[model samples]
Structure formats: C-alpha cells, structure tokens
Target: MNTFERSGKHLAIQSWQKLNSKLFSGFTTREGGNSTMAFHSMNMGFHVNDDPDKVRKNRKLFSEDIGFPVENWIGSKQVHAENIVKVSKEDRGSGSLDFDTAIPDTDGLYTSDENILLTSLYADCVPLYFYAPNDNLIGLAHAGWKGTVAKIGPAMINIWQEKESVDVKSILAAIGPSIGHCCYEVDDRVINEVKVALDGDTVDTVYKKNAAGNYQLNLKKLNEILLLRAGVLPENIIVSDQCTSCQNDVFFSHRKDKGKTGRMMSYIGRKGD
Candidate 1:
C-alpha cells in the first residue's frame, strides 16, 4: 500500500484516491492555512485552544480546496475512548464550527450516506479511515493510546456490522500519519492496557522495550492488527509511515511541542450529493 503523499496544503491519501475517485479521504498537513504562533498554519482542530476564528478559517480553506463544504462536515468531541457513532444527514453540522455542538464522547464515526464528511482531530495519535464501496460506507477514527487499548479499531467494525450489516471482508481500512514507534515511548501503564487489547498476547512485532525501561509502541501497527482481528482482510489494510513527531515540520506533534501545539484532521466522504 502506498503511503500518503503531499497534495496541496494537506497530505491526501492518494492510494485510497486511486482505489475510488469519488471517495474523498485524506489527512491534513499543518500548512496552507492562515494561523500563527504554535499553530503556524492549517490548524483544523477547534478544541486545541487556538483561536476559534482561525480554526474556522483554516477549515474553510480545506473545505474549498477539498471540494467538501464545511457545512457538510461533521466532527466530534473525541474523548479518546472506543465509542463510535453512526452518522446521518441530520448530524452534518455537529462540531464543524464549534466544539460545543460536536457529537459527545465519540472517538469514531461512520456513515453509508453520501455527501456528509466525517472528521476527527489528531496530532500524534493514529488516524483511521474505513471504506466499504459495496455499500458506499465511509468512516473515521481517532486512536490515541487510550482509544487503541480500548479497541476503537474493532469498535468501528462492530458498529458497521451490527448496525449496517457490513461485511468485514469488504471493509478497506487505512492507517494515517501518527507517532511511529521510533518516537512513541510509553510507560508500563500504557503497555498494560495494550496487552489487554491484544487479549493478553504480547506480540514483539508491535513494540520493543527501550533501554529507559519503557516501550516503543507502534500505534499504526496496533490499529492494523486490531482491524485484522476484527475480520478485515490483511490485504485490505494499508498504513502510512509518516510520523508526526519525526516530521514535525510537516505536522504538529503534541509531544514534540511539549503538549502546546496544533492538530491535523483526517476526513472522508463522497465527492458529491
């Protein structure tokens, strides 16, 4: 699977784009918007304490360029849990312009409906995108360590299967830019939760214990494994190698910036109504 490439101000998921022309799916890069200070430019997250006006402006730029209006987009509170929401046309404007109106306590969202974009904010945490062309379904997830251990990857698959009767084999998944194992070292507490998510099975391929007595956790690999465990075919899953902390020049990293930073957004939707 090809990793994301630079497209305009954002890094578009070209591999997925090649898979489906009308499927608008990609993650934003921290360029091409009019913001300053820590945000610099292209900051799309409203709850990151950046000026709301600038965030809106940045979103509008992305909307115009991506051909999806901000009005047709829906965002969420992203509580870093495994909670996933099934979106509808009625939920279009939630969290688009303001965080207060965003879907409450949701870390993942999916929809079979057309023309509505589902979005989630991220810095170093993994960004997950799902598409099932047979049913014309698309989904997005924010998988920080908490959400990953909570099995948010499987949570999305479960919802689509239960609510929409989607076949896991038909679900194509993409893991977007995140903090790679090289930069994401965690203490015992986080690894313990990851162990639980892995059903008490520790795979050495997922992480390596550092000399600091912590572990270098591969979040993207963790998500890929979760999707595979949830029944998505191994060939159906793709992952991006871009690391937020390593490529801080192209993205905002919460850890690289010591927690005072901006965020990028991962979005997916149909091209038109």
Candidate 2:
C-alpha cells in the first residue's frame, strides 16, 4: 500500500522492507544538487544540456547519500524502446561519468551482480522496478509512452524468465512517480496508440475522456496492468501516487516545464558484503 518513504532528498521504496538488507532502491528528488537554472539542483541527467560537472556532482551527492558509489553506477541511452540489457561487474560505471559511455539504445537494465547500481533518469515517464528475491536479481526500466506501448514491462519479465529462469509470479514490481492522469491529457494520436497496445477493457480502465474530448491516460496503471499480465502478483506491486507535473517542487515535469527541465534518477542495487 505504501509507495515510497522519503529520506533527506530522495524517496526510498517502502516495499524494500520485505527484501534483503543489502538491497537498496529509491528515486531522487529535484532538490540537493549543484546544478543551476532549469536544472536547479539534483539534476542527475547529463543529456539534458546541464553542465556535465554539475551533473556529476549531483550524482556523487546522491550516491554518497544512498551508500552507493557513483563509480559503480550503470546508465543507458534510453531511446524509449523495449531493449533490456543484463549488466555485470564488467559493465560497472558505464554512463556513470558521461552519457556517451552508457549502454547504447537500452531502456531496461537487470543484473544479479552485487554492488552494480542500475540507474535511469525520468521527468514524466514511468520508472519500473523489478526484484526477484529468490533469484537475487534486480531490474530497472524507463517506460515512456513509446516504451510502455512497446511492452517494456513484459520485456523485463521475459528477460528474467529466459536468462535467469525466474518465476514471473515471484517478482516484486514498483511503478515510480510520474505525470498522473489528472494532468496528462493526450490527443488522438497517443490515445490511439494506447488503445492499440491494450485490450478494450484495459483501455477503458486506464483512460478517461475529459470534457475537452482529450483522454487522460494513466501511465502508472497501464504499466501496472502490463506487469500483472506479465504474471507479477497484485500484492507484490506498488504504485506511487505522486505526479511529477503536479508536485513540481518535489520532482521535475517535462510537460509542466514545457520540455525544459531536469530529470530525477531511479536506482536499485545490492551492496557487496
């Protein structure tokens, strides 16, 4: 029932209470960093035209606060596709220091390796987290409209089953903060894509037409439904109520900021003993 627990400048996943003590997962806020202007503070994304040094500093602050080293963080180019990559210790620090060095054309990263942090930046898109305690595996995915329609949730599930032989029902999934349906109105183009991606009942359950005739699409619920269809248990899923556009003080919103904004980082990893 609980979404995320706020500590200092970040929000830790409350469901982590049921997991191993070495497991760490959370989403960053827009506060407490060195970036200025549109990036302001805590802009952990280097591709947003923010100063690279400031982005690095912000990343360092977050890593130090979370007890994870910046040097161990792994990133991705995030083309909003369903490309999921399995990371290892050898892939550590990829995209951590810069965007060019990150995994190319990947939106989802999964690994059972300890001390390798999986990270992705977000403004209004969904950040999907998956953990299979039995397998000691963790994964993170960036699900924008394109990625969600591409079925990235199911992609992660498929990867775990194919690569790690994980039972889909045992995976714990969390949908992170993003623009909610209340403020996210989509035109026919996006609505049509969503309608095609989901079933009839699912489309009705996740989308509602407003007075202005535009549809309010619930990205979080859509992703949750996708996870459920992928066999993740209903009780094992946590959906955050926080909307980035509505709570601009605590988070960044690409739409609210008119596409000019910083990005929050969603990260998960297991610490080495």
Candidate 3:
C-alpha cells in the first residue's frame, strides 16, 4: 500500500483512500512555515525553543492546509512513555498555541470526538497513527525508542478496546517516517530493552548486529509487529519507507541535528460535517 502520499508540504495517508474523506490524517514536512534558524521554516513544535509566535503561525498554516480548524487541535507534553490519553471536546486547544497547557506526560492521544484534532510532535521518533473507522476513533502517538520499547503501539490498541469498546481487529495502523535502521545504531542498553519488549523471533526480524557489535533497530517494523500482535489485520497496517534523518531536507531529525532541531507534527482527526 502507498502509506504516505506527499502533496506539497504534507504527507497524506494514501492507504486511507477507501475510508471517509472527512477523516483527515497526515504528517507535516519541514517546508512552508515562518520559523527561523534551526527551526528553519515548517517547525510545528512549540517546546523546541522555536519562537512561540512563529510556531503558532506555522500551526495555523498547517491546520489551514489540512482543512482543520486551528482551535480544534490538541497536543501533549510527550515524555516518550506509553501513556495514552483519551481526549474530548474539552481538551481541544490544549497545546495548540502553547506547550505549558499540553496534557502532562502523554505521548499518545486518542479520541472519538469529531472535529477535535489529535497531534504530537516528532523529529526522529516514529509517529504511529491509528483509526478505528468502525467506532469513528482516531489516535496519534509519538513512538521514540523509549516509547517503542514500552510497546506504545499495543498500549494504544488496548486503550481503544477497553475504553472505546473498539474491536482490535477493525483497527487500522500506520507507522510514519522516522530514523530508519540504516542510520539508527544502538548500544546494548537499547538492544536489551528491545529484546525484553519483543519476542525472540520478532527481535531478530527487527534488529541486527553490526561489525562493531552495535545493533541496528527498525522501529517501524517493530511497531508493525506490535500492531499485528495486538490483533490488527496485517493488510490494514501500513509502514512508511521515508526516513526523517535520511531526508532531513523534507523533515526534521533530532539525532541528525544533534538534539537541537525542530519537530514535524503528525495529526489525525475527522472534520465536522
């Protein structure tokens, strides 16, 4: 499946073509914004030391481009944990214009509330998108190595099943652009954690040891494995081949920029009819 289809400055989910047209889901690129310096142009994250006003302006531009209201956007203070929060109308605009008002320590946000956009920031971290069309639920998660080892993908699916009464089998999952295995080399600490998080066979499939003994971990494939284990259909999961670090011109990369980079925003929601 064509996971992400680039249209100008954003990458829309081509796999969602058969779904409701009003279900807006995509990730922003590092183009077409007003931020300066390290943030360059399209930085959508307010916590990355970019000018707040510039970040706000960028948000407005992105929201307008995606056909979603800027006031309807909600975000979180991502802590790289598996903490998924169920959002509602009351949570709208939480972290839209500022970072202080974001949901505390939340890396994933899911909602059945229409017209409320759920967003999370990312640089090299994987952006996991979930949709349960059967229940009109949408979810967005920031899955860095910490969150991935914590199995945040499966955690989101569990939340949907328990809180939203969503059937896991009906969930559609997408793993967005991040630092791919070609550039993501990790030491034993991360490798051990990944080994602990995933099954033995799956670990082999998602990780490989290099000559220096460092391991290359594929976060996207690991997340896909997590989704499959959580009962999502194999055919319903789409993994993007785009690597944020590899394509820094189109996206931001935390590692590639030595931790002083901006962030791209990943959002999913349904507009009001």
Error of 1 at 31 (Å): 0.6
Tell me the whole-model lDDT of each prediction, alpha carbons only.
0.90, 0.91, 0.89
Clashes of 3: 0
Score every model by TM-score: 0.97, 0.97, 0.97
Q: Which stretches of candidate 3 lie over 4 Å from their true place?
A: none
- Cα lDDT tens digits, model 2, 203-262, are 566899999998999999999988888888999899899999999998989999999899
Between the candidate structures 1 and 2, which one is better when assessed by lDDT?
2
The TM-score, computed over Cα atoms with residue i paired to residue i, of candidate 3 is 0.97
Q: RMSD for all candidates, in order, please.
A: 1.1, 1.1, 1.2
Task: Name the better of 2 and 3 by lDDT.
Answer: 2
The candidate scoring highest on lDDT is 2
lDDT of 1 by residue, 1-273 (tens): 447888877878787788788888889999888889999888998888899999999999899998898999999998888898888999999999989999999999998788899999999999999998888889998999999988888988898898888888899899999999999999989888889999999799898999999999999898899899999999888889899999999999999999989989999998764
Which residue segments of model 1 deviate by more than 4 Å?
Answer: none
